[model samples]
Target chain A: MGAEFVQFSLTPVLIGVLSAIACALPGNFLILRRQALIGDAISHVVLPGIVVAFLLTGMISAVPMLLGAAGAALVAVVLIEAVKRLGNIEPGAAMGAIFTSMFAAGVLILEQTDTSSVHLDVEHALMGNLESLVWLRAEGWHSLLDPSMLATLPGELSRIAAVCAFVVVATLMFWRWLKIATFDEGFAQALGIPSTALGLGLVVVAAIAAVAAFDAVGSIIVIAMFICPPAAARLMTNRLGHQVVWSAVFATLSAVLGYVLAGYGPFWFGFEGAVSAAGMIATVSGIILAGACVFGPHRSRVGVAQQEAR
Target chain B: MSRMAQPTIATDHGHSIDPARAPRDTALAIHGLTVSYGEKPAVFSVDAAFKAKGMSAIVGPNGAGKSTLLKAALGVIPRLSGEVYVFGETIRDARARVAYVPQSASVDWDFPTTVMDVVQMGLYRKVGLLGRLSGPVRAQARECLDRVGMADFANRQIGQLSGGQQQRVFLARALAQDADLYLLDEPFAGVDAATERAIIGVLKSLKDEGKAVVAVHHDLATVRDYFDHVFLINVRRIAEGPVETTFTTEHLQATYGGRLAATHLDELAVADGAR
Candidate 1:
């Protein structure tokens, strides 16, 4: 059991956890800034980015694909803003129009292109091949410390782990600025903080996270990880510091619990095959958010001490 | 234009002149400040100065660019052409000496932050990036809350606060800055009478301590009672000086234009007579 688990389940679960953390870290700020939909938009537009990268490079390598996705996200942001200002449309409507159009265009290109020769497909884009990315060379738990065995680990694992570490370090370094800017942008600018640049940086960081996670867990889980964890965490506390911690914990729990259930819950039900891990993970996060909404201590805005004082 | 306030002596560069009699230093000075949304100039070629040891009101009718002027001067909004000085130095050079309290409506009140957290934001510069909030800094933030009468509610989520209490929390944040020049936008809007009195009292105290307080004030009734000086504008600057000299019927009419109804004109006339 131990050797088989290390070979098949460990890397996918680790990737899910790292991806959830990467996306959820920035989601906390995005939710407070009322830009939660940005994650959804970026993930949708990433399809076009990867498609274009594949077309350009005639390959499906990670670096070019990530760059293409980041580029697409940047383009989507600019296009959304332009449509908002020039068309005088509301932000939500603008984002909806742009991301859907870009995603449709991506699907069209993907269908027209000769991508069958490659491992890429629409299903794979929506539901990543998490099960296929197993540690084929691993023998047991001891494979973790064996440098020779570790060298054969899946590329997606290392990429996501590095991105997750990057996101964590960036959050710590810019915690104060992010807090103030998210709370009050005018005051942040007054204090000479480059708030607009910071806002753009946040979107870029979020785009990077989405693209990296998209490579491992698919866009559906990426979107869920971005919003559900942070939103659930928000209901858990009135303090941002506490909210962030709760989000991370919730994200990890969803990744682990969802992975386990998706892999083994079928056997208990007398089923033949396991369900999709990516779908299971997204569903679990949604369940967590719904639970937080219903039962989290700070869920309601009314009946708080400050409101009662009034 | 000739009666443009006693403290604001227009130099060739439109900077304030230090007259010996007033013995007041210019805390904020704006020269030829023009801001526009598209082609319609919101604030056109306006020159104004606010001095330390006093409270000044920027009075104007709706859409008169009173907020625009402040936002433009502070570089919060882009300007067509202007220069702003804080404590006789460029605003960029004197940012540490400046504090801004944007309209309460400008921020998301439901953001997950406590009163103490918002106040501590004022000390962000002092705290520096990558540095944690030290105990002394937190104590100072608490003191600012106490001054605003929100000490007991330090841990209270900001959204749960009433409008007046929220305004006080914003004030506490500004107070924590310990700024030399304070710029506030509609600090009294949606606030109760008690909050109004408490806020004005704080501004007066700041003025007494030789700090400069500038606010975009909408309530015409309280302009005279609440401000030491007034700068009136309607797209273009109308009149500015000590409230006694500048808050005149002629200037008020020009600032309000036809927007000031005859009824309000009568009220102003009555108020002017009472004054």
Candidate 2:
């Protein structure tokens, strides 16, 4: 039983660590831009896109599902922007309305779908099964690698690799422009930087990252992965570069610990061993965020008192 | 026009003379410039010409649209009508040569950034995509900080600085841009005397380097002392010319007469009632 638990922990730990790192990269910019809630919104709203892709393709391919989900997320952003521009609504109000409405629409679409071959389970969507991911395998790798190595690469490995690669390339390519736009949009415009393009690009990257993490972690868990790590790191540091590095560290640590705890937690508690790994990881991230909220340097009661005295 | 043809005005400050320098060329020309906030006009139609290189002060009563006029010139605010020309070219063509120092109050000081980081933002223009800041950019940023006496505080967070220091840091950032035309909005609004002097000295040096500077100024006493040219305004351009001529009691009456008269009568009436 102990050996079985250790084996089950390995895949969850690896996925959790990689997914946490990927989420942390864009997490810094998302929190700084004050669009942290958009991660939650995108994660929830992408369900309909996932369902539609599955219905048409008749297969659960990561690429098509992600692409479709990205399209839907962009539409949501456009709707929010239109609400702000045409209706003269405040940004928060517009974002709140668009995200909730789209999320409900996605849930409604899921309920109406008649296909049983491809089941879109709410529990699975809200809390992913990291243990089963160990057995899954992606094809075509056998041609490129030795059979032994190919066999070792889990099916979910390809998905995680693709997500990481996308995050790194996008972040590096737009680092300077993103920095300028994040710091001051008006000033960036004055300097001839295309602030609007940079902003929209960030939103797309954010949506992609959120959706990519959705299956590894559930939609709700993706929020904790995307927001809590960054928020904790931001409380500790002011420099953008340092914040990104620290956030990655915090996220990876939490993922490993959370995965280990999820695997053994059932044995100690005498409960059903069916608790979701993604949910546990998210819970760990939430604990970290809450601790940082109380003890973090920026708004901590102790820190504020010290500052006041000084 | 000959350099000697222009009149020079002497004031308490011995260097208050126009220096009788011939206007090099028309750097900026404002014709019928009108700016409004919603339906209410902040700046009425006004025509003016700024010399290629000099310190010009925009001064008047409260709600005189001084900052609004500067914002209009910078193309930040949409103008109701009319046009602004720089070096005989429209604002679009002249943006590369212009720098702006927004009011310190316009931003949240608590924003997470250091003074050097703020100053480095000035190089965003010169450094295009994939354009890294060369050694010269850093050197120039340092030089601007030194010019404003903020060199030592470059690495300090902006929030740690006082109001005066914050204002100086902003000036340093603008200086780093190395633009030919500068529009500053109330640089001395809440600064200390030393900081105010430092800013005025920097502006005077910019003038010496033949850079046109239009500053939204509040202190009427310093208008004649600090500026070579002055524009007295209310909702519209009341008068704009050499400080010696335009800073007259008549223009002051026309620009601030309504409020000043009301206050004077209220004081007199109070005195009579007390008696």
Candidate 3:
């Protein structure tokens, strides 16, 4: 039974690791840009987008739904900016008003919809089913990458892998521009660095990352993935480059450890056997962030003394 | 109002030279320049040419568009109408030759960045987008820092620095730009005496190198000593010429005397009431 549990944990661990990487890369820039809260806002606001996509397509395909959510998240950002610019409202107030309204609208729409068999449940959007992930598989890849080989790996795992690869490549390609833009927008503009384009590109990437994690981890947990790891890394380093690398490390570690704990936690606690992998992962990430805030190098007494001496 | 009747010639050490006599060149020429904030005009239609390659001070009361004028000159602020020419060319065509130092309080000092990083940003014009900081650019940044006596603290986080040090770092950044025209706003405000001296020295050196240095100055007493030329402004140019000619009692009355007397009287009345 222990071996079965261990074997079953592999897919969740993989998803966790991939999601962590995907979230951490953009998370570093988002934190530096002072737009960390936007991640939380977008995660919640993308709900209506996902539901609308499902309603229109009448399918549970990840690609079309994620693209639709990305479009919606971008619109939400634009709306937030527009409200601030046009209405002269404070940014925090605008973000809070817009996201809550959108999220509530999504819930209302879901309740009114008659498609119960379509798997568009609000509970699924809040806390994902990790058990179902084990059965998820890719369809067309069997003919291209060896039909027999396709039988060995679940299709959802492959899709998650593809998402991770996309994130890694996108981050690498845009790292230089992102670093420049994050540090100083005026200087970036002076150099003709296409600061706005790079900024929008980052928002798009962040949206994509949020959408990728949305189904597997749900909205709240995805927000934790986007925020906690990078914030934890920020306490340890001041340099942007170091922050990115450390955040990726912290995120990957949290994912693997969280999956293992989720698998065993139910048996130990005498609770339902279907433990929430997303909750465990998010909780672990939160603990790490909180730990950094307390005992991390910057906050530690020793660190303060050293800095003072220097 | 009677202060205007006094002679412009005020002698010290028995030397009487006419204040109105100084060379003039079209250092900065503006044609009907206007700038607005929202709906209100901050700077109105102003056509003027500052003298070339000397220390020029722009003095005005608060909200008189002193900083706005500098910003407009730098093309940082959107002008409602008119064009600006630096030297013989348009500001757009001469962007690389101009550098601006904004007010010390304008930026959040707590921003996570090092002094060297901020100074190196001045080289953004020459480095180009995606351009890495090469050895030469690093050397130039180092040189600028050294000139400002900030070479020892190049790697220090800007937030950790003293106000004077931060101001010096900003000056160092302007120095790094190697600009032919420098515009600074309130560079002396809240700075130490040493920092003030260092700033004046840098300005003098820039002038000696035949670069135009225009500063928005607050200290009226030092205007005669520090700046070779002065522009007394109150939403409009009251008078502009060499300090000897323009720093007259009439100009002082026109710019600040009445306002100063009223403020002083109010302060004295409050003191008497307290007693």
Error of 1 at B6 (Å): 23
For residues A13-72, could you state the per-residue lDDT of candidate 1 as single tens digits?
Answer: 999999999999999998888888899999999999999999999988999999999999
**How would you class the docking of model 1?**
medium
DockQ winner between candidates 1 and 2: 1
- Model 1's TM-score against the true structure: 0.94
Q: Candidate 2 - CAPRI tier?
A: incorrect
In candidate 1 the C-alpha lDDT for residue A39 amounts to 93
Q: Which regions of candidate 3 deviate over 4 angstroms?
A: A1-8, A135-198, A268-274, A300-310, B1-27, B48-52, B88-92, B249-258, B262-275
lDDT leader: 1
Tell me model 3's lDDT, rounded to 2 decimals: 0.76
Number of clashes in every candidate structure? Answer: 1, 1, 2
lDDT of each residue in A56-161, candidate 3, tens digit only: 8888888778877887898899999999889999888888888898889889989999769877788888876665665234333233366664565555667667
CA error at residue B72 for candidate 3, angstroms? 3.6
After superposition on all C-alphas, the RMSD of every candidate to the true structure, in Å, is 4.1, 8.1, 9.5
Ranking the candidates on lDDT from highest down gives: 1, 3, 2
Candidate with the larger DockQ of 2 and 3: 2
**DockQ of each candidate relative to the true complex:** 0.68, 0.22, 0.14
